[model samples]
Target: MVGSGQLRLLAGTLCAYERDGLAYELQQALVYVDDLLVVGNSMKGINCLKSLLDKEFNIKDLGELRYFLGMEVARAAQGINICQRKYALNLIKDTIFLGAKPYSNPMDSNAKLYEKCGTVFKGPSKYSRIVGRLIHLTHTRPDIVYSVSHLSQFLANPTNLHYQVALRIVKYLKNEPGKGLFYPSQNNTKVKGFSDFDFDWGSDLDTRRSITGLCFSLVTPSFHGRVRDKKQSQGPQQKQNIAL
Candidate 1:
C-alpha cells in the first residue's frame, strides 16, 4: 500500500492498488484520521477492499458524501456542486456585515495599497481575523482570492484603509454566499494552466515586488490556484531560476 504525502496534515493516509487480472481497474482508499473513503470503478472491487478493512477495523459506511470539512457537496446527473453557503453566512453574520451593501467587485482595480498609506487601524486583530476568514473562504470562492491575498500582506501592520477594504470583501461575499465550483460528471482529465505576471512592475510599495497569478484547471473549472507577490532572489543563481 502506498501512502500520500500531500494530505499528511489531517493524518491522512492513502492506499492504492491495481487489480491483478484487470489492468484497467484501480482502487484507492483514503483514510483521514478515523474517516475512510473507498473509491473504485467497480463495486465488487470496492466492496472487497472494504470487507478486508472491516476485518481489521470497525468501519461505518456513510453511504454518499454530502458534506466534508466546510464544503457542501451536492451531486446531480450532470455534475457535482460544492459550496460553503452556511460558512459564508456565519462569517457575514459574525462580522455584522449582513446588512452591508453588496459589492460588484472584490477589490477596486484603481486602488493601490501601501504599508504606510494611512493611520494604523485601532483593532489590528479584527482586520487580521477577517482577512484570515476570507482566506479560508477562497477554498471555494476563487473570485475573492486575489483580494484576500492582497490583504494578507498587511496582516502585520494593517491600516484603516486596509481594514475598510477588508470589510468591502465581506460585503462582496454577501452578494453570493453560495458561489462555488462545479465539476461535471462527464469531463476529461486533461490539466490546463493559465498564468499572468503583473505588467506594472514593483507594484508593492513596501517590498517593491511584482505579483504573479496562476490557475490550474481540469478541462474548464479551476481546481487549484495561487496569487502571490514575487520577492527578489538573494543570489544571482536564484534570480536566474526565477526568470526561467
Candidate 2:
C-alpha cells in the first residue's frame, strides 16, 4: 500500500490508507514504536490486514481494544465505555493525595485565577508534573478540562493558589475514579458538535494581553486558549471522520 499509494504515512508512526475490502472509504493505523492499532470500519478487514502485516512484521492482533495507552476500554451490547480508572487510581496513589475528600466540582466557579494574585510556589516543578498528569486525565474526564487548562498556565511559576486548585481537581477525580466516556454503539454515529468562544473576554494581567477561551465538544471535549489576534483563533476544521 505504501508503494502503490493506497496507504500514506501521515507522520511518524501514523498512517492513512484505503483498502478495497475495507468497510469504510479510508482506514488508519497508528504505531507506538513497537505496537500498532489497526482501526477501520470493518472488523473482518482489520483482521485480514493484520494477517498480511504479520507476514512482513511481527504483528499481533490483541483482539478488540480493551486497553491502549492509559485508557481502559470496555465494550457491551449497549455501548463502548472508555476510562482512566486504573490510571486515575494510580495517579492518586503516586501523588499521595488519596486522603483528600471528594469534591463535587473540579474548580471553584467564582475563582478568577491569575499569576499575580497568590503567594509564589517555591518549588514549582512538582506543580508542573501534577498539571501534566491532569492534562492527560482530561482525555476521559471532560468535566475537568477547563480547570486543568486554567491551572496549566501557571506551569512556569505556579502559586500556592494554583496548587490548591489543582488538588481540588484531584479531589473531584476521587469522586468517581472509574467514571468514563460512554458512547452507545447502537445509536446513530452522525457527528454532532458544540462550541463557544469568549472574544477578548478579559485580560491576562501578567502579559498585559487580552485572554480568550475557546472550546468545542463533539462527544469528547477538546480545546485551546490564548490571546492571539482574531484571525489566528478560528475554529479547527475536521480533517478526518471519527467512529466510536
Whole-model lDDT, model 2? 0.69
lDDT of each: 0.71, 0.69
Q: Which segments of model 1 are wrong by more than 4 Å? A: 1-11, 21-34, 37-42, 222-244
Model 2: per-residue lDDT, tens digit, 1-244?
4675545667664344554664354456766655566787666655555655666675545556666777777666766677888778888888756777788899887787888768998879999988999999888888888889888888988999998898888888787787777776555544565565545555455675665555544454222211111111224433221222
lDDT tens per residue, model 1, 128-200: 8999888888889988888899899899999999998988888887877878887778888888899988888
TM-score of each: 0.77, 0.78
Q: What 10-residue stretch in candidate 1 is worst by lDDT? A: 235-244
Looking at model 1, the pairs that clash are none
TM-score of 1: 0.77
Q: How far is candidate 1 from the true structure (C-alpha RMSD, Å)?
A: 12.9
Report lDDT (Cα) of residue 181, candidate 1: 81
